[model samples]
Target: MFKLLLLCLALLPAFAGAQEDSDWIEYRDAYRQMIWFEKYGKPKQFLQNHFRIRPRDKSVPTDGLRLTLNGKATHVALPLDALGRAVFPFSKAAYDDNAELAVNRKAGQLKSGAWVSIVTRPDGVYAAADLRTACDQLLAYLRYSGEAAGKSCAGVQFSYPKNDVSQVQFHAAGGAVTMLAPKEGPAFSGDAVTTFRVFVYRFAALPETGQVVTSSTPLAIAALLE
Candidate 1:
């Protein structure tokens, strides 16, 4: 019995390590799924440009972009190019803000243009200016191309992980029911669609080395209007 107890104690570390690895793998897969959903789920025409910030790039800090729409301030960490311009193809959260009016108001008064600023925190590292231009471009794409119309609904769909995880929790800007289905198939089925809003969430894991790794593609949902 004593020998058996010692053997079990010796195996504890291995078991714990395996568990940790399993968790990290699950998290990474979820993250990848979230990104995939955000990217491929959209109509190809709607995604004319791609705007994203890589999680690993030190140059693109998480709090690089600040948007003051309506009267509230929203901080966004978005990807940038070598020219310091934000890439196109933003997520819904990037533009869906109550303070859009305030952002336009504070940026500048222009007939066909607006001003936006990107300033880093703590050290106050300024990255770019006239971010509103990029936003305007995105707005134009959404408006003229009808991309925005595709994302104005209410519902939630689950994107299952590759592993045998029992449950996965997703984050959303609004409160909605979590359904056990892929949102894309039903939303695009051409059944008297009423609403069109989509949300995306990623599962990630931070290793002890401080490296963030994604496991799965991002998951996205298009809520039916009703």
Candidate 2:
């Protein structure tokens, strides 16, 4: 009996190391999956908003899932029917700012095991407009503080309305034009039009700050039919 006990104690370190290695492998694979989605998953980006987990041990049910965005407080309670799946709330605010998603494991109330998978959807839009024109108008607005010519805008692609469109600006920096769309804005009115407002910051060369400011003109829905 003494020899048997000695053997078991000697094997404990190996067992612990194996478990740690398994966890590391799982986390590494998950990180790689996220990176792939961010880079090659163009036209459709994924956000790590929702997470689901299927435990290796089936006797345990998920107790809950907690989400942390930039160290913010965000938590979601698991449903009674949540057996192999857990749903979390996606924050548009974090997604727009390109925030990272972090997941925390919960101790199951009913059993002694837990495992989970994370899932998220991409919220991007490809506008039916001329890309060049859109960029031109965007740049012009930033440079001269003027309105963009409607006909010039085309094939404009943007992330979802995580923010208002009116206050966004286009600017040139590091030899490339960049667009800055803020998360929220007060409403603004134009010529006979009540336009929704959003703040846009463009980086461009100006006489003063070497940067230009511009606003996005509202896209007319009626023009789509014509």
Q: What TM-scores do the predictions have? A: 0.18, 0.20
lDDT of 2 by residue, 1-226 (tens): 0000000111111111122212111222233333332343222211121232333343433345333334133333443222222333345554445443333433221111111111111222222122233344333322232222233322222212333444333433333444554433211111111222333222122111222233433321111000
Measured on C-alpha atoms, candidate 2 has an lDDT of 0.26
Q: Model 1, residue 167: displacement in angstroms? A: 1.8
Task: Candidate 2: list runs displaced more than 4 Å.
Answer: 1-26, 45-51, 64-226
Candidate 1 scores a C-alpha RMSD against the true structure in Å of: 24.8
In model 1, the runs with Cα more than 4 Å from the true position are 1-141, 147-151, 156-158, 161-166, 169-226
Q: Predict model 1's lDDT versus the native.
A: 0.24
Give one digit per residue, the lDDT tens place, for model 1 in 9-107: 111111111222111112222223234323433333212222211222233232333212121344433344321224332334434432121111111
The backbone clash count of each candidate, in order, is 35, 14
Over all chains combined, what TM-score does candidate 2 have?
A: 0.20
The lDDT values for all models are 0.24, 0.26
